[model samples]
Target: MNLRKEILVTGAAGFVGRETVKQLLAEGWKVRALVRTADTNPLAFHAGLSVQEVGDIAAVADWSSLVSGCDVVVHLAARAHKTGEGPNAARELFRRVNVDATVELAKAAAAARVKRLVFVSSAGVMGDFSARPFTEADPPQPASEYAISKWQAEQALREICRQSNMELVVLRPVLVYGPGNPGNLERLMRLVASGLPLPLASVDNRRSLLNVRHLATIIGRALELAEANGKTVLLADGNDLSTPELVRTFAKGMGIKARLFPIPPLLLLAAARLLGRSHDAERLLGSLQVDVTLKTNLFGALPREETLRGLIETGQAGR
Candidate 1:
């Protein structure tokens, strides 16, 4: 009988998925990468990796055969957030992909007798802004359809796991950033590269962010840590960077100078609100810190210099 521990990873082509699969392979775990398409798979060069093409994660039925025999399933696929979506439409779309699909996958994992299911959830489930660092004790108040869907999915998975006696580990990470990252981070990178004077110097809000590699490390640890079973924990770098600081750091990482000027927080908010961008205002001018001591205390702090180096490398990579 083969003694290797087998693991299944969904969304194997995504940023975090790619890194997680690579790290698992390096650690000698047999990885079954489930991706929507096999063509140009990032895991192609990886040795000893099993690739399964399961197009449209949300629509897939009968995951039992694929999940059978895997020790753990790391689920990372979901419907990405979009701008200017109506409440009803957004809810239904998010439910279709994030909630409905995830519950289906969890049911399959449970049926397969998988020991654990590590789910990648967003910190947005706690809302876009928080005056203080969010903790596990706080009740969820999801602010958007995407976040609401994730929150609902978490609840559903918890019940499913409870009923099936399967371990569920949910990780909520805030604003993951790395090379080739999309969303606001990529937009910020572009803005910084433009050398345009940004009126964010006076904004004194703390934002927590996670590096893709760091998140991957956490996922790996969750798979092995018995203490992590049946827990919902938040993941962050534990280093909070303000908007100005982030801009400066990103600029420095790119070997350029940041052009920034002080702008009143209230004024920024008013302008954003006027432009029908309250969400953008809150993200830019508000704080969304998360208490990540739970993971840091277990793994120790990721050195600031190491993280800065990663930022620089990511910036240089120009993605």
Candidate 2:
């Protein structure tokens, strides 16, 4: 008569996935993790955790073996932003991996009578032209190959779930940062830790960031909340900051003084272009924010003090 729910987590070896698996396990839910390989197993030492090694998500034609008997399927596997391919090649690769594989998995989950499927998407699907914080009501304007593929996948899943008995929930989270986080946030942390003077004091752009821990908790809530079904949620920490503010906050977390000086935003952009780092400058100087009220409605608002503490802890961990 035990009615504990069983959840299947795809890409359970990745950063966010690992945290999600840990949270779910701590909550007493039986977890079945589907990873690409045994070598990539993140929960290897955990007792009673069921793991399946499925090689190459893009190549998996059938997901029945891993998805059956699972009440919720959290699909987190996707071909992230991969560079150095031609336009056609990139499109095909993205379609094959993010779109096709996702659709196939959703179909299998529906057939298996899964109650819900939660898709982890990216905020990049909103594109780079947001005049303000992006909300779920905004029309999608995905620009990159990865974003395009995710948007397509969302559309496909919505239609598929609309036709099937299973429910679908899509979550588009802003740049997720936390312990062992990679990419731009990590690079920024490294720069701040090096004690180098930064010229980002004058860049007055706002950005929204989500902590991986919070994202994991949100995923769990999405699975349990029936109201979350058939909805796309835009996620952030509910605290937006300028690049200078972020640098200062990160420095505060690392216990270092931010030696930031004022530099004209236009001048910074020109210098970045001259140095062949336009994209880097754009991220630092451009505004990329998200509306997290929907998320707050589901999981409650994340306190600003708690968010800063988490960022500080993440910075300390990176050291």
Candidate 3:
């Protein structure tokens, strides 16, 4: 935690990136935020922070100057999962950004003699749902184009770092929800705030979720923990919530009363189909959990209440 230590963070204007940079700065690390452009980046001027405009991840001509003199690199940029694209098109794009560009950056970091490279991977690399809690020990079962790309990136990074002797930390985090990111959590927050009757009560499912700040802390830990070097860790907030539980928690976080009623799972699915929200409904009812039982966490959990508070302080419609 020396004040002189410096870090390079890609996707520095992103949801997790902003918080990660803030955390590192608060902990006495100088940060160089690699952003797409100053026009779109939201980070304010800070003495300890510097902004560098490097366009799209896949098209960046070189990463040598970007990563030079930085002790650590936290790679958080990737092609997020989206629909309405052809599978072939999606696969190629994902590979370019998630795999090709990632390995490119890692190679530059190694060549620059960066001390550590922390990769933010997706738990989707293990598939959407698991029969039990997932662990790093589980074999990757990437089913989506995006997840496959991340898996490939992790593989390439390990080999690249091994040859160069740079430390690599791969983190597979499940369902990270916070202020600016769009996901099931944001939409659910709107529904809960709308004061509509939600028929998600009595629904039983557990999803291991992480706060952006918690994941940021873990990213910092990856730098400090020698035990975490060269290891892939599955991270969660260490608290799993059922659908109804999540609704209630979000409601409480928003200071709204949850209006949940019991509806059979089949009936809910049928209603979702009628409303053309079957995909969202399925995610609401599905169970995706991970084991965050790692001994090197060093920091404790950030409660659901704190995550909700973050939403109030920093929610942005689109970023």
lDDT of each: 0.85, 0.86, 0.82
lDDT of 1 at 160: 98
Work out candidate 1's RMSD over C-alphas: 1.9
Q: Is candidate 2 or candidate 3 better by lDDT?
A: 2
Ordered from best to worst TM-score, the candidate numbers read: 1, 2, 3
Q: TM-score for all predictions?
A: 0.95, 0.94, 0.90
The candidate maximizing TM-score is 1
Backbone clash pairs for candidate 3 read none
Stretches of candidate 1 above 4 Å error? 1-3, 83-89
Ranking by lDDT: 2, 1, 3
| Preferred candidate (lDDT higher): 1 or 3 | 1
Model 3 TM-score, all chains together: 0.90
Q: How many residue pairs clash in each candidate?
A: 0, 0, 0
lDDT per residue for candidate 2 within 147-184, as digits (tens), equals: 89999999999999999999989999999988888777
Best by lDDT: 2
Candidate 1: tens digits of C-alpha lDDT, residues 1-319: 1327899999999988988998788777889899998886777566658899999988898889889999999999998765455433657778998999999999999998999999999998888789799998888998778889999999999999989978999999999888888777887888899889999989888888888898888888888788898788888888788888888878887888989998799998889889988777777888999998787865457777766777776777652
Error of 2 at 225 (Å): 0.4
